[model samples]
Target chain A: MKFTINRSKFIKYLTDVQRAISSRTTIPVLTGVKITIDKDGLMLSGSDSDISIEIYIPVADESNQLEVIEEGGIVLPAKIFNEIVRKMSDETITIEVGENLQTSITSAKAAFNINSIDVESYPNFPVIDSNEVITLPTTLFKQVIQHTVIATSTQESRPILTGVNITIENGQLKAVATDSHRLSQRIIPIEVPESLKENSYKIIIPGKSLIELSKIVENQDTIEMMVTQNQVLFRAENLYFYSRLLEGYYPDTNRLIPANDSTKLTINANDLLQATDRASLLSHEGKNNVIKLTLTDDHVELSGNSPEIGTVEEALNYIEATGDPLVISFNPDYLKDALRTFGHQNVVIGFTAPIRPFTVVPADDNSDIAQSFIQLITPVRTY
Target chain B: MKFTINRSKFIKYLTDVQRAISSRTTIPVLTGVKITIDKDGLMLSGSDSDISIEIYIPVADESNQLEVIEEGGIVLPAKIFNEIVRKMSDETITIEVGENLQTSITSAKAAFNINSIDVESYPNFPVIDSNEVITLPTTLFKQVIQHTVIATSTQESRPILTGVNITIENGQLKAVATDSHRLSQRIIPIEVPESLKENSYKIIIPGKSLIELSKIVENQDTIEMMVTQNQVLFRAENLYFYSRLLEGYYPDTNRLIPANDSTKLTINANDLLQATDRASLLSHEGKNNVIKLTLTDDHVELSGNSPEIGTVEEALNYIEATGDPLVISFNPDYLKDALRTFGHQNVVIGFTAPIRPFTVVPADDNSDIAQSFIQLITPVRTY
Candidate 1:
């Protein structure tokens, strides 16, 4: 294989494909990025068993300035090849396969001759033969992923909880994730096919895959999603991302959210977030890493204490406080993560008891989209 | 003790002092910052035995807006205190010593009550009682430190090599550092005291201390340096930095520099630096981490090979390559560091033999200052 392209433009595509490659893969060939040059364009593929990414640079795009001297394929070591390309001292670079499977990469007066693996040894990406496709707005889908992925369990003890449960029905897409102690849910609207609109679909995608997909699809306006029995593909204009689906069933979290509250507090999310951060500083030095929030008819206060570090107390500024007085203790890091998703909007926190879970939702949310999002956290038993 | 000062300005002094405080110190009191408040202003001090820093915020400085309420002293935990002050929610923060050695730090509505240690337990900074002072230009001295510190040995095997030898005679101040394999030396003119003109001074300051002093002295125009029997004090307008002297005889490095060469290569420092960086990428993956430079009457080329990986070759662009044909191999990282000190200037590299140490100096160095700076690197024997 032989080809030359604009160095900077090629680096952009290479970085996207590299996100799917892992050096710790058991399959040695999986650590290599497969490169193919055809009459249409150049394609780079990388995978680590669970997730695969392929980006294409079309020859029709004049900016790429792609010149294909010969059409073929080869797999090079991803880590070193990327460093070589990044440090090359010219605006353009050329790569050619020589005798004995040796590849020469040249730019300016510098040349690097590296060993290459046979492209035929690389594993093939999973094929999705289903015609059913679901179109999603790039921005909205990214928001859904960011909001719920935080609640996904990072521990592998319960592998199913490490994935977000996504369900589509009646043109509304709902995503939920819970790690037993905390839960987050977001609903967004998407265009469902006529035949699939009548049939409901549910899939559990690993949180890591969703994060990588969100980053690569940032520039695209919309993404086309196709699902097979064991795999799902998210397609953009020039990129194809595939992820394996988790086989086990996701736990039901609807019953975990409280329907009523005995005490409520309304405050700006950013205001409470800063106060929690300050209190957390002390708690983090302590053994339990927990902070307490006390609500009364006349005042709202947050406090944290570490036996070795002393105590911190802050009289928080809140919009309103009603119902019964309550004191709740929880891991401050959880609340900090949940509050960040609400931005600067005012959020209403509902609490039923000090030992039970509490819910935080947008205070002035009246629209269907805003009302459909909620974050719940289970408080620690300080008593 | 009680005082209120501009939070941002106070933080600046706190950060400087905290640099001298280390949590890993054997003395627990050394982990705390000593704060002494008087009618004049507030003084913050921290020490890690090897290095000590004291910064005074005077009431006369309106920018500080420092208001002293009482005269007393206490030592607060450095790490947590700095964090609390940084995260406080007001433009000005008030710190007051309450009953029972508990200090209350208040800003806006947030309050943090932390335990404090008796100021008497903190060690006192060393007194450098020397009438002789050497005045050096801030920018020039900083440049001297940056150029020589890179050659200082990071390994503790040769403790004396970890410090830079600084000597002052007549009106010239010279600094030199070496790690056995490489050496860097720089000399600049400084104003000597009238009484000390006939007396010469030599001291070895730890490389780590010089790096920290350079960072904190960026805003000052000139710095006054005083040397005592066992300590050196770097005094600015409001800051005092004291470092312990390394007690050892520095080896004479002047005899190691070659007075003549059989081969020379002249090239832009940045151009060679970039090419060296590219070649080093492959050598770093190999066992020896060395790159080769071949110089002939017609061309100069650089190459690196890794038995398990591959090889890289580049024909260097040079202004001149003359004398006997030669091939030398050395660590690219050492050359890269030396080249960075020259910036974009054209440098003349002098070589004698394949395994002998070579020197790099400014090509067009006509000024005394430029001619006084030189970097030497010993080549490795590949055979």
Candidate 2:
């Protein structure tokens, strides 16, 4: 492979693909980024066993900086290649395959002769049909994923729970994730025409994959998401992100949600988040990591206790009481996750009882804002 | 105890004191911060076995805002106290001890009642003698610690090697740290005439302790250092940092450094660091992390390799070449550490050979600037 390309452009693509490169990969070749130069452009690929990312830099960019002399391929150590390209002291860097499998990279004040791996040893990436694609605004997709993915279970006991269940039904895209202790669901109500709505499309994407994909995407462009039975592909302008889908069926969570609550409290999202945060400091030290919430005729009290350390009780003054006052204890971390995921200006939390799960929804009377979104928090026994 | 103080002021002190508190202390009371209330002020104390930090918030500074009715004391869990104070929902937070060893923390729309431990269980901070004191610009002390501390051996094989040796003689502060493989020496030329000049003192301050002390002293302020036989005290404005000095005689490192070398290379600090960094990406994966620097009549080449992975050779454009051709291999990490510690813009590397030790000094025309500091790195045997 012999070529010269804009340094920043290569660096940008390297970063995009590097997210998929895990230093701890069992397969040695997987740790290397496969670089190929064809008639059209240059391609950089990085993969772990789970996910692979590929980014392309076309020769004909605005800078007219990429010039190709010979089209070939090589697999360079991902980390070394990345560092060399990043530190190249020129606007454009030149790379040429030398004898004994050496690849020479030259710039202004530096020249690196690196040994390249045989591209044949590297595993082939999964190829997908390009036709079945769902397009969405990159920024909106980022927001929806950010809001839903945090609730995904990090525990590997149930691998499927580590993924966010994304479903498209009736011109709406709803993403739901839960660890069974708490759940986060966000419905992007952006109008999709009938042709773009596919009824058979439902897939669960790993939260880690979604996070890396989110990093590779830009707000200015539209991202194409193509879902297969086993894999999901995200295609941006110059970057392609691929993630493996969870095989098991996601739980039917709709039945577990309560329709209405006997007691409800409305509070500023930031204020309640901060209060619960303080309550969490004490509860976080507890074995169950549970914080107690007590509602009375005048105010609501948030408290937590660690048997060895101490107890903390914080009262929220802005309380509107209607039904019999309620006191419930749940994981402060879960509640924090719910509030953080929603990131709404104001939220209304409705409680059924101390043992059952509670519901937190947008305070504004717009179900559209709360469309397919539902978070459930199971109270931990604090007694 | 009852008092209300500015939230920001309390948080600042809490942050500093938090540095002295560790969660894994063997002493249970060390996990708590002692809060004492008096007619003069409120004292917050946090300590680990080796180091202790204390801050006093005077009542008069509150300008009538801080109201203290009762004078009492308690040891609040350091982490909990910090979290509560940080997350309190008011501009001014009021903390008061309630009946039955409970502490009540009140803010605008919130009130936190936490359990407090008896103050008697907390260890009393020893008062070090303040009669012998040396004062210097905080910047100078901070720079002295920063420049020489990196060379301290991380291994506990020899406890004394893990501490930076500070020898105050003839009004000059000489700092030295070495891991046996490399040594960093820095001498201050300024002469301050006082008791500091009359008495010469040498003490080994634990590397970790100096790091903590460096944190307390801001670059802007002048700091006072009080030396006791067993402990060294660093005082800056409102914050006082006391650390127990390591007891042992530091080994003489002066004999290891060569008086002169036949071959020397002057290079840009930033460029050489980056080049070695690129070489390091491969060398770090090797056994001894060896990277070779080969200086020819024209240029310098940095190369590193692993038997299984590959090799990388980066050529640096020579600014000027006059010394005899030299080839030397050293642990890239040690060289990188020494390179980072040298604050000079350019570095002059004095070399002997592949198996010999080398010196790196500030590349300055002025003799005084170069004479003040020298960093030595021992070459590794790649064979």
Candidate 3:
């Protein structure tokens, strides 16, 4: 391939695609990025078996400053290619493929000839049909991903728990994730084409894939999501992201949350987060890393103690508290993560008992706390 | 131990002393920081045997906003104490030591009760007489440390090579360090007090200790240095930095540098640095990571090749070239490190042969290359 491209534009897209290339892949050719130049444009792709990212630069897009002198394809080592592109000083770089599958890259006064693998050695991008598509604004999709992905299990022993289940039920799009100890659910209303309303999607997408997709979808106003029985594709302008679906059935978590509350407290999210963060400092060296919270008529107190290190006590004046007075202990790290997901100024916390999980949601004057975004944390036994 | 001090002031001094506290030290008490409050001021100290840092905050120092209410001392766990001090929100924090070594730290709405060790359990700070001291501007001392510390050996097999050798001959002060592969030397002239004019000293200071001392001596006009038989003390204002000297005989590296040159090339330091940096990319993935340079009458070409990866060639226009045209191979990392040490815009490179070590010096029209500063790199036998 003999092509000249804008250095900055190429570098930006290459960086985005490089995130999908894993260094420890068993397939050696998967470590390299495939570059193809033809009459349409230049396509760069990278995959690590689980996820694949492809970016296209159209020939007619003058903003990218791309020129096609010849048409060919090659796969270059991703690590070295990324290093060279990031350090190139010239505005434009020219690349040409020659004998022995060697590619020459020249810019300003620097020229590099890198050995490349045959393009045929790369795995083919799986065919994904764009017939049934769900379209949403990039901003809304990003918000949903951030709200629930944090609760997914990092341990791969339970593969289903490592994914965030995205489902469409009765025209409502919701994403839920739980790692047994905590759960996060986000619900949003989206518009779907009338022809595809009969079909619903309940696919479990790995949390790691959604994190990478959110970063790659920047600069686009809207995203088109295409789902199949085994794969999911998200298209953002000239970029396409594909991820394999987790095969196991996700555990039903609806019955896990309690229906009634014994006590409820309304407090500022930032104040509670800071108090718990400080209290956790003393408890972190302990085995359980548990912090206790007690509510009284006038104030709420958070405390942590360790035998080796001493104790810490932080008190805050809650907005209001009703129902029975309560005392409970839980992992402060889980509570911290739950508090960070709330965008509202005040959060309503509900407790059934010290042994059962508690619920946290954005405080609303008129609506029920269960309808919108909710996070649940299972308290640890401190005794 | 029992005092209310400005939170920000305490945090700054605590951070400086915390660097000397190592988690892997065999002595358990060394993991804690000793805080002593007396009629004069408050002292914070931490040590890991190799280096000890002590910072004193006087009661009357308005800049530090310190106030001592009682006279006592105790040692608190360094890791937990540092974390708590960093997160304190109140303008002033009150710390009181109660019965059974229970220390209470209170600020605004946060309170922490931490266990502490008796002050007697902490090791005593070695007293070094200041009668024979060398005083120099902090800026100049920092420059000398930076110029030679990078060449010290990181491997501890030869403990002597891990320290920078400092020598004083007449009124000239010189520092040199080498890892056997490359050597860096810096020399400067300074005025000595008449009482110490007759004595010449040679000492080796651990490179790690000098690094920490450089950071602690910031914003000071002058620093007092006392070199004893086996230790060095650097006192900057209220901060005293003490480090044990490495005990061994330093090798004589003077004979390793060649006196004559077969080829001499004058080139822009930045241009040469950037070219070699790019050429090293392909070679970095190879076994030796060596880059070759060819000096012709017109230009200097830098090239690197890997049998599996391809090749890179970078050429730069030199200001001038004299002596025989030559080709040489060396580790690009060593050349990069040597070039980075030269603060001058242009440098003169001298090569005795393809297999011998080469010298790089600041470009001078009339002075000899060996006069001010010099760096030597041993070339690899590419043939």
Candidate 4:
């Protein structure tokens, strides 16, 4: 493409689209960033097999300092192009496609002529119904995804479990993720038009895609999402992020959470997190990676022991304790993750039995946000 | 051993000594830090076969924040102990050894009881003459090492090429390292006491050990060096860094550098560095990684090309160009290294024939410091 644009602006657009580019892609052309310059502006698109991103720089945007001298398209090697743009010291950089698919990039005293792939070989974008797009605040979207995405399974054996299942029903958006050992879920009250009130929607988005989407949409206020049968697109101001949807159904996890509890303990989140972290120091790998928690009348003891290494014990005074005194063992990493997901200052942990799963919720549930979030961890049987 | 020391001060000592510890050591005890608590204070030492570092915290040192309750010694696992000490919130941490090599680490409300190895199995320090030592400013020591260490061979085929050969004679300390493709040398003048004037010494210190020692001696003003038959110890105020010397004679690299030149180019160090970097973008790996430099009577041009990829060309105005116009090709990485190692603002490159190695020196070599540092890089035959 023949064009001249502000160097920093071009870099910003390149970085946004580069989030979806993978150097290890099986498709050779997927390693390039497709650049197109036409009547509208310059569009930079990058894709792995799983996700694709496109960021557009409109010619009318004065701050971008873009001027189109010729209309063309080219796919440049992602890594070399990125390096050249970053290392160029000039304020403005010019790119022109010459004979034999050779592209020359000139900036001040430096000029780079790199091979460009045919744009026709690039994959086409999936079709979507733009009229049925759903809009949500960027902040709420980022928060819900961050809290639940971490709990998703990393194994690809069960593809559905590797995604965060997002559902919209009764004017509320809920996101849940679980890897069987632990589960995290968050709900946000959203406003939808009356025409879509009776229609419920659920989509399982790959956790990995959500992480990349979060980084690209940081500066935007709202995002428009268009979901089709197989792919979902999240549109920001000048960026479009598309991810493939998992085909299988997500497991019904509502029945897994215990409804009643016999023992409860309220403690500071930081204190419990620290104690578990220290206890995990001695927990051996390839084993259960378990740490025990003993709740007594006056205090709680957290300890971890390894046959090869030694043991660690930490006792802390709880804010309040009730029900029968109990001892339980579980993977300390899961407990740490649960505590970290809770933004509240105090956490109230509920236990049904030593062998059963436990629930961690905010001690002060008066706030609307805290009332809608919950994290559950399944304990490991020490015996 | 039983002692309560200021947690932060203890952490500092542990960090310094921990640099010598490696998780991949074949010797089991080398992975553990030997901690000795006595009337003097606490001593922490770690070794990875190639190098060992010992840091002592004396009870009398100001702000060391140490107290000795009993006298004993034990070896603790480096990773676990470092983590426990770092995570403790208490200002003072008390460590007490119990029966059967069990250690109780108590800090505020937390206590960690960990396994400790028997101290008797740890390797003993090498014997050296305490009276005979060479001292130099830590800054000078750091500078000479940094300038030459990068040139050391990373391959294990020839073990001697991996070490930096340091020689002291005629009140001057000279350091040189080469990987056969490129070589770097630096010298610094110093005053030696009359008692040691007659003694001249040459030792090859492993480049990796010099890198670690440089980090530990950053805050110290002066360092004392003790060279024995097979080991060299770098001693700071309260720290001892011992590195095993590389045996066998070093190659005679003094004759490789050209003393006269038919062509010379004087250019800004940054300009040359940037041009070579851009040129390298198009230089393909495994295919020579070559970049060509064309020197004319007026301007210099740098260009690189790959058959599959394209080409890059950068032209820069030089301060001075003399002799005949020439076209030469060399690996850009080696040239970039030579220019980057020079501390001078501007670099003067001396060239003989296109096939001979070139010398990169400071353009303004009036100062004593500039005259002592020289770097040489071999050129690849382009034909």
Candidate 5:
């Protein structure tokens, strides 16, 4: 397409769309970014099959300085075109399509002529037929994603575990993810229409897609979400992010969390995180990568040992330790990840037994919605 | 052995010594850092056979807060020890050698018991028999190293070309390095001892070693260099850096520089560097990885082409383009690397022929040292 725009402002939109483009995509045309310019504005689209992103630069925004010389469209190689734009030695760049599907990109005295694929060859974006839009506070939604996504399985052995199960019912939206060994759940209040209150909506979205969506929607106040049978769309002011939904049913994880505890330890999340990190250093050099935590009536201690590297022990500082004395061993990396989500807040860790899964929840979380924002980790059997 | 010191201050010394320690070394003991606590102070040493570093933390330096309880020595695993010290949860850390060659490292309530090797098993550092020390200004010497090291051959086909040939005589030190295709030479004035004026000393120091030395010697005003038959020692206030010399004869590169020129182009070094970076982007994607420069009486242009990708052309902004009209092709990466050394200064490029090597020299250079700094690049014979 024949168009010129501010180089820096255009780069910002290009980077957002590029998140959906992967160099390793099997579809060759998917590796290219589709650029369409009309009398109104310019739209850039990128997709890697599972996720697609589209950003529009409207002509009404004077800062963009967008001028459409001709109404046309073309798809250029994303990787090289991005490099060319970044390295161009000018404040503004002009891109024009020429004969034989050759495109000329010029900025200052530098000009590059690269091959282009016809825009018609690009696959059409999935049509999100549902007109019902669910508007959610960006900050609360981001927090829910950040809290639960960590427990999502990165391995593809169980593909359904790779996605976070999100359910909206009555006035609350709940997000849960579990990789069998660890689980995280967070619930937040939302405005649910009366028509959909009876029919709860449940969708499993890939955790990877949510991360990209979170990053690109940073400055926006709210995001509008629309769902179809097989696809979901998150729309901001001028940005649209679409992700494919996993087809299989998510496993029921409610029974996995313990209802009662025999022992409890209250400590600052960051303090415990640091001790676990130090203890794990030696364990990481060993075969099992596990650390032990011993809680007594009067003291609490963490220790790790490696036959080749030696041993590390730390008398942890805790606010309180109560109930029956207990000793537990687990992969410290799981606890570290869960603790990070709590930041500087004090967390109460509940243990049912030495072998059963333990739960960590904010100590000061006295909310109306009980058991919200809880992380559970299955302890390793050291004995 | 036992000593307690400020954690941050001790970590600084440990990091410097760890630079010389590589986990991939054949000698297992070399992977450990040798720590010797004497009545005077603590000495930390690490070596990878090719390079050795020893940093002394004296008791007189109050910032170290080093208190030696006993006089003994041991070698602790470098990587794990450094990590433990960094993650220790206290302002000060105490390291003590307990019974059975087991060392106890304690900070706050955290304790680590790690296995240690006998100090006698660690190889001793080489002794430099020469008493004569050559002092060089740190800033100027660092500049000389930076200007020439980029041209040093990374390939081991010609082992001698991997080291910079440094010669000192008549109150001047000259350093030169080449990868055969490109060469960089830099000379700086130094105060030569009266006794050493009669004889010129030539030594080939590995470029890799010089890069490390430069990074560690930043705050020092001057560095004392002592050369022996097969080793070179660079000593600062509390640091001693030793590097093995390359045992080979360096090829004479003076004859390769052209004495006369038929075409010349003068431009700001930074301006040309940016243009070269842009041009190289396309060439890097191609097979030959070469870009062409055309210099005429009025204009200078740079262009690069990739058969599968496309082509890029930029009319370079120059202060002067005079002499015979010419077109030359060469690897833009080499030119970019050489141009970066000149920074913001204007440079005059001299060319004798399209196939012959061309030289780039600072345009404002009128020093009596004649060619104090110069970069030469051999052009590719592109038809």
Candidate 6:
């Protein structure tokens, strides 16, 4: 196969596909990116064990263009191929495959002959059979991943907790993730498919796969999600992302959330975030990284202490506060993460004493006031 | 003792003094910054075994706004104090020393009760003595250090090579540094004392100290430098900096350089740097990090290869070529460093042969039109 492609176009697709290629994969061939040139365009594919990304570069006529004389395929080492394409000065790079899988890439003043592995050596990706499919706006999908993915457990000891729990019920798609210490839940309304009307299937998707899909769907208009028995395929315009679903039952988290709270606070988002951030500096060195929040008349005082490093106190202005004054201790890092997801000006935090889990919600971020989302953080006993 | 200083001024001074404060110092007192409050102002000092830094945050007003009710001093842990001062929300933090030597620093909504050690426990700084002193713009001092310090050896096997050789001869101050493989020499005229006109003293100043001073001095204002028996003091406005000098005579590097060469090539500096940087991408993984340069028929080819990772070749543009057609190999990293220091659009490289040493100088950035400042690099024999 011999073809000349625009350097920038090839570079963009190469980088997009490289997101899934892991250098430390147990499957050695996963480290190589598969490149195929045909009459339509050039397709590049890369995958780790968990996720796969494929990007297509169609021949365009505006500027630097590509021409294909033959149809063939080869797998090149992603790490070295990326560095060469990024550093070459030529506007266009010509790639040709010869005998013994010898791949020659030539630019303006530079030429490289790289030995490539046989494309057949790569593991054949499972063909996704689809009975259920749903379409969602790319922006909304990316937002769902961003809001809940940070809450997933990084430790794989309880393999089930490493994935985000996605559930669709009563015309709403809710994404929930928890590391046993804190939980984030994001709810969005979508046209429910008639096939999923029986019961909500607890689909647990690996956090890493969602992160890669978020990057690829960032500025796209729409994305088509095809759900098979064991795999999920997210197809955007010319790029296809596939991730294997985790095989386990997600825990029922609905019982952990409290139905109501005794005292509540509406506070400016930035002020609360700044106060918690300052208090975190003193608590980060401690064993649990816990910071205490004390609420009174119209303000909340955030305080934290390290036996050797001293203590810090910050007064946060609140929109309103009621009921008995309450004090609770929890991981300030969880609150910091929740604060970053807020695009609105104010947030309302609800508490039921120190023992029960508390929730933080956007004050006016909800279209329907009765349907407000909440982030529940478990309190740590600071004795 | 008590005083309130401007937030920006205190933060700036704290950042400068923090360079010498290491977290793992053996001496517990050395890990702390000493604060002395007297009628003059507040002095903050930090030190490790290798270097010491002292910065004074004087009262900012037309005169002195520092009201000293009593004179007192204390040493507080530098790392914790700096973090507290940096994270405080108040524009000006009020600091006061208690009867028990405990320090209380209060900002808008925050207060810290930091424990402190007695100031008498802190090590005494060396007395300032000037045998010879000269003054130059801060920019010139930084330029001098940058030009000569990069070639200093990092390996401590030969301790003297780890320092930059500084000598003053006939109203001129010159700096030179090398690790036997590459050498950098820079000279500029400076006024010397009448008593120091006998001969040049080739004293090796530790390269690490020069790098520290370069970071502190940031402008074109004149800074007075005084050289004592074992210390160098740089005074810039109200700031006084002191650094310890190395105790060794530097080697004479004059005879190692060739007087002139029959073959020379003037090429664009940017083009040469890019070629070397690209070649380094592969050579860096190889032993000795070597790249070969072949000049033939007015064209230069920069090439490198790793047996397992393939090879790369590129034709480099030459502005002028009178060099003998030959191939030579050397550490690409040393050439990269020399290129950074010798900042010119085009540079003329004079070569004796493939196995012999060579010199590189700016095409237009000559210290003198007739006598160009030359950097010499010894060639490596590659079979």
* Candidate number with greatest DockQ: 5
lDDT of 6 by residue, A8-84 (tens): 97888788899999999988789999998788788899999689888877765445387887788999989989888
After superposing candidate 5, which stretches have Cα over 4 Å from the reference?
Answer: none
Candidate 3 has which clashing residue pairs, if any? none
Candidate 3 C-alpha lDDT tens digits along B1-383: 57888899889889999999998999999999999988888989999999999998997788766777779999999999989877767898899999999999988889999999999999998889769888877898898898788889999899999999999867778889999999988887777899899989899999999998888788578888898989999988888999999988999977987889889998888888888889898788889889999987777789998888888988876888898888999999999888887654799999998888999988864533245578899999976
Please give the lDDT score at residue A278 for candidate 4. 83
Top-down lDDT ranking? 5, 1, 3, 4, 2, 6
Write candidate 2's Cα lDDT for B1-383 as tens digits: 88888887788888888889998998888988888888888888999979899887787775435667789998887887888788876788888888878888878766667778888888877787677777777887788889889999899999999899998877678899998989898887544556556787799999998898888766766777888878888887667788898897788887888887878888877778877887787777767678889988887888888765567777775455557798888888888888887544788888777678998888774645334788899998867
Better of 3 and 5 by DockQ: 5
Candidate 2 has an interface RMSD (Å) of: 2.5
Off by over 4 Å in 2: A190-199, A317-321, A365-370, A381-383, B60-67, B190-197, B317-321, B352-355, B365-370
Ranking of predictions according to TM-score: 5, 1, 4, 3, 6, 2
lDDT (10s digit) by residue, model 1, range B1-383: 99999999999999999999999999999999999989999999999999999998999999999999989999999999999999998999999999988999999999999998998988888888888888889999999999999999999999999999999998899999999999999988888878889989999999999999998875578999999999999999989999999998999999989988999999999999999999999999999999999997798999998876689999999999878899999999999999999999999999999999999998988866644899999999999
Q: Kindly report which residue pairs in candidate 2 clash with one another.
A: none
DockQ of each: 0.87, 0.55, 0.81, 0.81, 0.92, 0.59
Residue B285 of model 1 has an lDDT of: 95
lDDT of 3 by residue, A1-383 (tens): 79999999999989989999998999999999999989889999999989999999998999789999999999999988988987777999999999989899999889999989999889998899668888877898898898899899999889899999998866778899999999998888788899988888899999999999998898578899998878999998899999999998899988987899989999988888878888889889887799999987777889999889999998875898988888999999999999988754699999999999999988863433235688999999867
- Interface RMSD (Cα, Å) for model 3: 0.9
Q: Over the stretch B167-261, how does candidate 5's per-residue lDDT look in tens digits?
A: 99888999999999999999888987888777788999999999999988866789999999999999999899999999889999889989999
Supply the TM-score for candidate 1. Answer: 0.99
Q: Could you estimate the TM-score for every candidate?
A: 0.99, 0.92, 0.97, 0.97, 0.99, 0.94
Residue lDDT tens for model 5, A350-379? 999999999999999988897788999999
Could you tell me how far off, in angstroms, the CA of residue A321 lies in candidate 1 after the best superposition? 1.1
